[model samples]
Target: MFDVGSGVSANWLRVVIALVCGGILVDIARHGVGPLPFGFAVTLAVACVFIPASPAPLLLICVAAAALTATVDSPFAPGVLVLLPLVHLLHLSCAIAALLPRRARIALAALRGPLRRAAVTQAVVWLMVLVGALVPVGRTPMILELAGLLSIAGIAVVVIVLDRAR
Candidate 1:
C-alpha cells in the first residue's frame, strides 16, 4: 500500500528483489548446474530476500557465474545476457531497499538518479557482452587478454566521466 507523499511501498521493492532472485535461480538451473550447488545457491537467494543488505546476493551471483563457466562451453554464451540483467536488478533493488525504512513509501521521482545510473551501468554491461561475444572461443590470445584489460579500463573511465558530469 502506498502512503501520502510517496508513489510506492518499500515492500514492493522487496518483492522485486525476490523476483530477481528467482530469475537468477532459473538461469542457474537452465545452465544445468549440479543439484548440490544449485540447492545451496537457492538457499542463499532465499536468505537474500530477507537480508537484502547482506553479502548473500554477491554470493548468489558468484555461484551462478561459477555454474555458468563450468557447464557452458562458451564464455560468451547467450544465456549470460539474461544473467547480467538479473544480477544488476538484484543489486540495484537491494541497495535501494536496504536504505529505506522498513515500512517506507517512496516516490519514483526520488529514485530517478539511482535508476538512471543503473541504466547506464547496464548499457556498459551490454556493450561488454557484445564485445565478448565477438571473440573466438578457443585458447585466449595475449591480444585478447590485453583487450580485456583495456575494455575494463575504458569502463572505469566512462563511469568516472559520467559521475563527474553529474
Candidate 2:
C-alpha cells in the first residue's frame, strides 16, 4: 500500500520475507517436523526481518526445506511443490529489502525487472523439478546429484553473464 501520504517502506518487504518464512514453516509442519526444530527455524526467520542483507534468511528456509525433505519419503510430495515458490519469494524479497534503506520509498517499476527475472528463474527450477520427478524410487545416483549441482552453478554463471551484457 504505497499510497501518497502512506508510502511503503523497505520494512514492508522484510515483512513479506518473514511471511514467506512462515509459509515454509507451516508446510514443513504439515510434514510433521517437531516443535524444537520448528522453533529454531522461527528464530532464523525473525532474524531475517532485521538482517535481510545477510545469509540468515536463506539459511532459515533451507533448513526448513531440509527438514521437510528428511521427514518425507517421497520427492513428489505436495509440500515440496508448495515450498519451491515460497523459498524463491523469500529470497527475492530479502534481496530487494537488502538493497534499500529501511525508510526508502520503493517504486513498483523498479520491481518489474527483478520480478521478471525471478519468474524466468522459477520456470527453470520447475524444469529441474520435472526432471527430478522422473527419477526412479530408490537411491539417487551420485552422478545425477553432481550433475544437478553443476547445472545450478551453470545457471548462475549464465545469469550473471547475461545481466552484465545488458
Candidate 3:
C-alpha cells in the first residue's frame, strides 16, 4: 500500500481542486449568463471528488449534504454554483486523461483490483439511479442520447487502443 501520509495529502488535493473548480463554474453559470439548476452544483462537486477515486458512499454523503443545504437555502450555494462546470470538467478530464491509446483510465481502474472494480460498477449504477430519479425523463433532449452514445463509444475505443498498445 502507498504511504498513509501521502495518500491523505493526495485526497486533500483532489477535494481542494474540486471545491475551487466547482465553485467557479457554478458561479459563472448562475450569474454570468446561462443559469444552471442548483442541483447541478452538487452533482458537479460529487463528480469531481469521487470520479477519480471510484465514487464511494462517502461521496454520496457529501452530495446529500449539499442537497440538504440547497433545500434549506444555504448561503454557500451561490459561491458553489460558479465552480460547477469546473468540477464536471475535472471529472471528465480525469476519465479522459487515463486514455492511453485504447483503454480508458476507467477501464484500467476496473482491471486494477476487486475493490476498485466494484466501485466503478456501483458508481455507474448509482449514477443511473440518481439521474433517473432526479432528472425527469422528458427533460433530457435527444442530444443527451447522442452524447451518452458518444461517450460510450469513446470509452470503448480507448479500451481497444489500450489493448492494442499491450
Among the numbered candidates, top TM-score falls to 1
TM-score of 2: 0.75
Model 1 lDDT, full chain set: 0.86
lDDT of 1 at 141: 95
Which candidate, 1 or 2, has the higher lDDT?
1
User: Tens-digit lDDT track for model 1 on 29-111?
Assistant: 98888999999998999878898888988898898888888888866677777898898889888888888888788887888
Candidate 3: residue 68 lDDT (0-100): 42
* lDDT tens per residue, model 3, 80-151: 433333444454434433232222123333334744654675568557655755665466788877998999
| Local accuracy by lDDT, each model | 0.86, 0.85, 0.48
TM-score of every candidate relative to the true structure: 0.78, 0.75, 0.26
TM-score of 3: 0.26
- Distance from true location, Cα of 109 in model 2, Å: 0.3
Native-referenced Cα lDDT, model 3: 0.48
Runs in model 3 lying further than 4 Å from the true structure: 1-8, 29-36, 53-166
Error of 2 at 46 (Å): 0.4
| Model 2 spans > 4 angstroms off | 1-7, 135-166
Q: Which model, 1 or 3, shows the larger TM-score?
A: 1
